[model samples]
Target: MARRSLPSLRPTWRRRLTLALRGIGVLFVLGLIGLIVAVYIQKAQLPSFDELKSSPNGQMIRVHAADGTVIVSIGPSYGEWLPYDRIPAVMRDAMVAVEDRRFRSHIGVDPIGMMRAVKLAVANHGNEKRFQGASTITQQVARTIFLSNKYDLGRKSREALIALAMERKFSKDQILELYLNKVYFGGGAYGIDAASRKFFGHGADHLTLSEAAVIAGLVKAPSHYSPTADADAAVGRAGVVIQLMVETGKITPAQAASADLKRVALAPEPKQNSVRYFTDWALPQLDTLIDESSRPLEVWTTLDLNMQRAADAAIRANAPAGAQGALVSIDRDGAVRAMVGGTDYVTSNYNRATKAARQPGSSFKLFVYLAALEAGRKPEDTEVDEPITINGWTPHNDSRHNSGTMTLRTAFAYSVNTVAAKLGQQVGFGTVADMARRFGITTPINTYPSMVLGTSDVHLIDMTRAFASVGNKGVAVTPYGITKVTANGDTIYEMQVDRSHVLVAPYVAAQMTDLLQTAVNTGTGKAAQIGRPVAGKTGTTSSNKDGWFLGFSSGLTTGVWMGRDDAKPIPGLHGGTAPARAFAAFMKPATANRPIEPFETQVTLPEFQLEPDQEFGQPDNGGFVDENGNPIDQSAQPPTDQGDEGAQVDGDGNPLPPAGDGRVAKPEKLDQDWMDRVLGRDTPRNQPAPGRSPQRDRPAAAPPPERPADRFQDSRPTQ
Candidate 1:
């Protein structure tokens, strides 16, 4: 039957062909309608030319100094816009050759390039560059500025439509400029200029062929090809770009050879992100001030770049070997001028200045003394300096000597542990803790007797702020870094400059300043004196684990801390030694240009005497004698070193020469001449004679029966 009816197989074939043709026509019309609808939707969603030209696709926060110097840039960053003429010819050519070979010949979406990319992807087993497919430079620009990378058909269609529209609206040169200026080059950089500066430490106009190739190669997979992320991969990708440039006739083989990949060096970061310690502290503050956005922001900070450099250098120079150091500087207006979290920021990012809660040692005595003064205890009030046991805890002076009777001024200046502990008891420990809070110390302060001796751990920034309040004439100083934030050159948020209420009465602050001044002038903080009146305190923790010097001179206040991160004792470390020296080193340059302002009020300093006059025929028994006229045991007692253990002072507050051959014991291997070398100071303090060993045994304190640790063992050097 089938053989007989080969019947009109021709008609059946024709009917099938007609059905197929009709289906194809209907599909063609439907496709045409869908394409038109997509075009209209994408066009409606398209941004204006002005918006596309100026708006960034991501958020960027640029932190600036008071002088507008960029301290650091956070998130995606952009550099100055470069005109087409200013863009290096090699940069433009390299980008064209590697990213879109048919860039100039095509409208925007190059079919030939797409086909080539398809062939490559198939040959490579679908391992095309991440974030890069067959998109042309113009299409990439459209995607970057206009469309999301949703990996959907609609996104790609929109990208093509925008690219075509861009081609018609802008000249080829203008399109290329937009592409170069708006594309991401990774490492938080956007735009050719930003990427050029980020990679080569210069502008796009100064890009060499190698540098240009390196930047151009990053367009495929910015994060993967970023030189900062992987230098070798970036160089390899750059080599591919150079080869493409040669193959595309953008450069000859000889020119490719001249584009030395080995010469492509990435720019070093801003002092190895040393300022990150500052920016990390300041960036989170912005979230509270403004709504999140993709727009670029400029954060004007109170940071002084010069002061920051000086503080960093000082910490580096003065921090002892095997120890970490931190410094924070603030101005009278509570502006944070400089902050150094550690000696090297790259090694350890733990912000010791603001984050580390360390025992302030004798620095905590500021609050104790302030509380005492507020309790109506005059600085000249007298107290006996004998061994005192409070709650079964015997507190000894750092010197381990009972120097008869002394005024409160002399006691606080010398950081006498016995006297401070006694004062803490006389004025309630709770009141002392309350005083600390009033002075801006936010850490939980313990009301124990040892709290007066700084057993409570506190942040350096808080300690510095407390001292700043005193320097600010009792006006509470809330330490701040950001002054204002601006988006696209328009103000978004600005700090309302309001100094907090008075923390203490003006006269009380003046009295406290007088005591601090005496400490720096003739006591433990002597090393911090920078040829001017300095109101400061010296703090050395148990076994010299932590040494701190917080001082204010003129209108600037700075705090310096030095110790092991693990809280191990530093050999022969004292607050008056390295910490004070660093304070002086930093403050000298930090305040060099500022006007010198004398403290508004000065208390009449009483005559401080620790020993009887030689004319009285009092034997030089080292200022210690019992009521029975017998010489006290001096064996194994810690000698008064530079800090806290008061140096012999005349009635006029002048430091007397060392006793017994005048050879002071110095820390081993420390540069005694660092002040002369780094600060150009001619005056050299006590220098140990040649061949004298710096090592001196510090007798560990006999811990109290039930105490956790002997807080009475003076951390400061004793006479």
Candidate 2:
């Protein structure tokens, strides 16, 4: 039977061929139907130009100065985004020449191009990863708008289908324009227009042929070929684009050669704001004015660039070796104009202006004087200068010698330690601390007796803020940085001033200002005195551990502090020497253009009066007087002398009577008595008496104490 069938095998082959042709025909019809459905679905999902325009999902980050100079940028948002007519002809030709030479001839997909790419990729044994990108211009646009950075077969397939849909809906020119506007160009630039400004500080229309080639090269690997990111790589890629242009006859060989010689002129890296000090102080206040999600903030700060530079230079110039310093300047409206966190930010990141905790020294005396004035005490009120011990603690003046009598104003102007301490004691310690807190001190203050001497710690920012209150005329206004924030021309935030509370009466603040003026004119803060009217205080910590000068004029208030990070005492440095000098240097140039305004004098009411001068020698009731007007005991006792026994005196220096009875008793030896007094107990068995060596004799006293060896043994035993 098989031999019989073999005789007609040729005819059987024909029958099989007919059946296979029918199967192929049926499959081709189904494939056509499926492709039509796919095309319809893809077109339905495609975004329209109007939809893209109204989408809020995209955002642009732009930074501008107060005067509208663009400082920096981060993202993109907008349709009709391209200056289409303004695009350079060279750039347009180069892009098509390098990316898609036959872009005008293809219908979003090129079978010939795909075949060539497949052949090259196979020839390289899969090692040449970038053998070819067979995608048409339309396909590239689809990938840029809808695909992710991930490289996978599924994404490529989706991009191809989308490109087919786009080719059917838009013209070749429209597709090319969208592709150019949608691609990334690194350096935080998202389009050709943005890239032009980022790399050349110009618009797309003005880009040179070489620059256009460089930008077109970045489409394959933006970061790798970005001029700012990698100049050498970008130049090499640009050379390839130029060669492609030459091969395509878009540019002559001479033009390509000249283009190769052109170098990339990238804009400089943007300058950092360097406003850390002011930002830290203003952060919380800004939070209250705007929500956290606000974008493109237009922070119309009070910062004057000139003043900030002057302050920074002055701080560096006046800062001593191995010492750090901070300066903050605010206006009368409580707006911070300038701030420097330290002498060198690169050396240390610690923000001394808002974070360093140190003693305020004599500057704290201002609070004491303010409290005294509020309690009906006049600056002219006289107080006697005598050592007065309170609860076993005695404070002394810096001179170690007190004036017999002085006015309150003179005492404060001289920063008399004893007088300030005495006045602080008279007013409650709690009262002074409360006053400081009201003036913006947020640090914890210990109400110990030493608080009178500024033993409390405070940040320089808080100190500067408190001093600004004086200039604000008793109204304490919080400082802020960001003024308003808008995104895509929509206002999202507007800064508002948050005035919390009234700290003091206007007249009281003015009186304090008047007293502080005397400090600048004749006291320790004399170095801070400028041509303009100013009031301020100078501070020097114990052993010169810290130096500070804080002052305010009618328009500006400033604080300066200098010290070492280790808290070690600085040599030959004081508040007046370094900090005051810096303050004056900064203020002189900062206030040069402002009007010279004087501090207002304190208003006197009918309740106040001036007392007549009393006789100097008279025991006055109005002035400070102790139980007796003679004098107060203000002496420390010295150690008594020990004399030997059998000592006698001649007639010229004769021995006197023990009392008025004229009894000339023999002088007793003082060795045992002196030893007992010095030791405050019986002498030890091994100890010697006065004028007697231990080797010669042992005094009659208790035996020396002993310790147990076991109790003194090391806690950790050796292995």
Candidate 3:
């Protein structure tokens, strides 16, 4: 009777729920099986353990100096394969303690370890929105040797399957050996043996327990934990690793405490010829010159080790304390033979020679003079060097004394700013900017009158390379660091440098070199004179912040700049002082053996009418104005003290040019440094800063009637 009366429950909600759960379980099982099959298929496409083991060695990048001597061996070099038994047991224990505690007991992929990693990842996710890794030694070996390091599920699954296959094929000890031998330990070290040598100055077999633990801790982040990078961080990480070993019973607590992290000493910083500056400059060229450096590569660079040594010595000797210096030397063909970016690359990695664009000051006179020459003016053309005002930015000569009504040659040789300004104005500032660009200057240039006196900042390498064209006799020399490139044990790319392209005609080069030669001989660049035929310019900024000596020897062109990185004035420093002396010091040895080349120029210059506001004739001294007799604005002037620092003109009979007197429009844009140092600008504020200097004062720019220094001293023009 009870069986007959039982209620039907076949279609109840509970039964329906049970059926749905069963369907989900089956789907989950099927999906897991499908994932496992897909992983196996992907694993088949990855490199096999044997194929990877026997792959070609991609070990060294040998950078050769100019004389074909290998100066730097840049990659990890492994001589012999380290067997598992040959490796110290302490190292193996330390690695196992930190990297994988259950490495011996678990299969290739440990689910427990993975779940623990996920938990930690969730708890400690600061800003990084992802899981940390729980890769066992076997999984690491799989990823390092047989698979690409990608984080997608497909790659991760393949990595797992490959690890499983690797575990099945090799013994536990064998897998451990492969991992220890192949894992990257940073500092270009690829294996345990190289890492041992790199950090401990010894082999892996001789590692102490402390060193082993310290090295083992590097598996997480080699660079961050490397003793070379930071000893305290390495010690802290090593301490954690030792604690893990103690908890795992690999070592006693007393043993862990006794382990001296200080025992891990850093290798000595190499004093050898690193050429880091040159290599750093050349690194960017690879993206355009070579497609990729996947295999072994060999590069022959343009570095001349001997010249580099000389340059370093020179920079050290001349650069003022607390001030920095940069030097760049280029051959006649535009090859950068030596580049000293700073006093020491170990102290500062900033490459001032290529990276900095400090104002050239009077050094920029060469372009303006050249532009004047291009505009039908000859070196023999007369220019009045006196107090002048143009567009409100008045520039003075390097010295208060100027050779009144001097020839254009003497004007450039002395770095006469007024004459340069007049010439720039006459030929148009755009013409001078174009001329500079023609010499390969890519930095943005302003068209203000101050640009004539090198208010425009320029790089040392660019200025040096530009001068190399004059040294090379008309052809524009393109600076290059790499001469040859080899990949996969074969010469894949050989540079056939096209030195035939002409940037300036031979006649123009000869004329420009001749003019520069006079500068070195009897001009402001007299400090750079090395006896033989040499041509260059000396430049000092308004505040004496940046000093420059850019010149060319018979065989080489070199540029030197001395200044503080903060743009503060170095007391009594000028282009004719430190930079010129350094140039002389470097060039004396660099050009000692080379033959002298004389500049031979044809004397032919066309005659052309001057610009609208122009003048072919000028008074000895006058208010600066254009050929149209228009009153030029000289509203912005330098500080009285700064104006007295560089070379400037002082004439006994300075005449004022007749100009149409009218209010001139203030320039919308000018050199910011000039604006900051000279005319104080009140922007987003009513008045200038408390310590700001006053606006341009024409009366203050005049020299004192009496000489402050002794007349008995050698009276060369200030630079």
Candidate 4:
């Protein structure tokens, strides 16, 4: 009785429908209020419209060579900022036709485009990969200026709110200006002007219809459809943009047909990207020179395009198979004229010139000799070139046998390891290391006896710079690339020429130059001789893992390195064989523009007379001596080819017989260095040759050549 019959609890269908509709309507109102609040919050977090208007579009750094050739353009590249009226009408129409057809009628966000995007997303089962975007040009401008490319409901809402705010504050023309000036178009280009110049080699103000369409098509996927990356895809995308323009009444059918799709050529790209290595090294220095700015900068560097081209050609021509090579050239004032980091930049951009630190091998002896000379040792002073042991370590000459006692000049010119070791020990290893530091070697150097033979690793650029100091006549120079920097036609920084920094006494530098010249003229670095005058030393590491040739001529200093990236041995790879050859080849052309200049100091080399028993063992005779100067048992040794040791080769690395090899067709000598003396190269000298008796006043044959002594043949520690 208390429960009384419950009245009919079920409502009629019409009533149920009305209740449901009311609930739905309430939820919709709440959602709308929440959306409005979220949008207000997003807009509040964004920059003000005035702040956006004053912000710079982007920052670009254009690096130019000494001759005004563009080496590289770093960062996001922006062109001249044009007003709405200055922009080509064809470009504006193309952008509207392809990006947002209802751009003029919509209030920042287009409802129809959103609905279509939603339908398409649902059809694709919410696949983010295949989802199409619905943002208008206004939304893109807001995102580019105020947001990252994060995809989420919160970001989309903020974008829309920002777009709405922008449209309310600025007119349609202003929005278009912002969009065209701030949008990215791949290839590091930002803004319509930059994009046009990047693809068509012209400014946006001079855009053709087809060119405008090509740029407009890049809005969807800048990188994928970039003309420089994929030309066919770029053309196809441009075709689609043209079709859309025709359908949107921006162009006629006949105009679309005559769009010249095939003629949409891209601006020529740099032939080689190796210049990037130089730019990468030079860009970091800008921070120390000037404060960060939004305006574009023009950096005038010390690079010589012609020298760079010559260096590249030399490396390509001389690098052995299965090996990589790097080169660096600097002027007397320490300006980097050219730098080749590796055989090819695309395959590997490790920047071996500035980054890779490898053992300098015998080339390290430069510091040893310099220390000795500064320590009161004279070139005429004699050192016994016999076997030497230091701290249980033994060093050998490239030929493995001693050349007996010789002048300090002769030992240095020969790159004799024992003499260098003795010199280092006498002058103190720490003193040698100090000398290296004074010469611009920044890497850590071990203060050990082995360091005298170049056991420590160093950068090619640093080594080249050290020689540049010598070339500067004992002046200490900091290797520099950027000489001046300008921003918006205003000078921000200019390199000051300071020549008062001296590293050594002029006499000491002159002596070192004399020794290095002898090395090139009559000793280990004979292959590097350039006919006029060059002073340098060659280095061949233990097991032939690395080869080096560092020299200076005509006020330009250069260093060459050849090796494998893995630090493995290259068979029969001596510094004189390839590295010195490359040096000569590059220097011949690089120094052609520079006038011939003689070294400040010159010295008379002492004559070294060899007894019949001490003669350099002919390649055919059984007169060879072992590492200890003992006669070798030719009977126990394996037989080898009987070709002349002085065989020559053409530019193609093909070998040619010696002049007197008895071959009917003797190939002409490629060069006339000491190596040619083995084939009896004859030249008239006022005085007798070094190895000959002081008797005749006429031309005489050079004495027998030493066994390929221009090498760091091997190194080992006895147990």
- TM-score of every candidate: 0.80, 0.66, 0.71, 0.74
Ranking by TM-score: 1, 4, 3, 2
Question: Local error of candidate 4 at 240, Å?
Answer: 5.7
TM-score of 4: 0.74
Scored by TM-score, the top model is 1
> After aligning candidate 1 to the native by TM-score, how far in Å is the CA of 719 from where it should be?
28
Per-residue accuracy of model 4 over 1-719 as CA lDDT, tens digit each: 58778677666887989999999999999988886776666656667656665565567788999999887878888787878999998899999999999999999999887788778767777566554668999999988998888866578777888888777667999899989988999988889998988888888999999899999999899999999999888899999999999999999999999999779778887565667777778889999999957788999999998888889888888888999999999988888989899999988888999999988877888899889999998887898877777786666543435767888887777676788889999999999999999989999998867778777889999998888888778898778989999998899999986889888888888888988887766556656767667889878765567788899999999999989999887764666668888998899989987898878754334335344334221111111222122334545644322211111222222343433533323221112232324323353444555454455223235542223221211111100
For model 2, give the 10-residue run with minimal summed lDDT.
Answer: 639-648
lDDT of 2 by residue, 100-177 (tens): 998989878777877876686677665746445577777788877777655555776787788888887777877777
Cα-based lDDT at residue 41, candidate 1: 67
TM-score of 1: 0.80
lDDT of 4: 0.76
User: Candidate 1 lDDT, tens digit per residue, 409-495?
Assistant: 878766777788799999999999999998888888877666777777899999999999998888998899999988887898988
Model 3 lDDT tens row, 391-413:
77665443334445767775665
Task: Return the lDDT, model 1, position 642.
Answer: 30
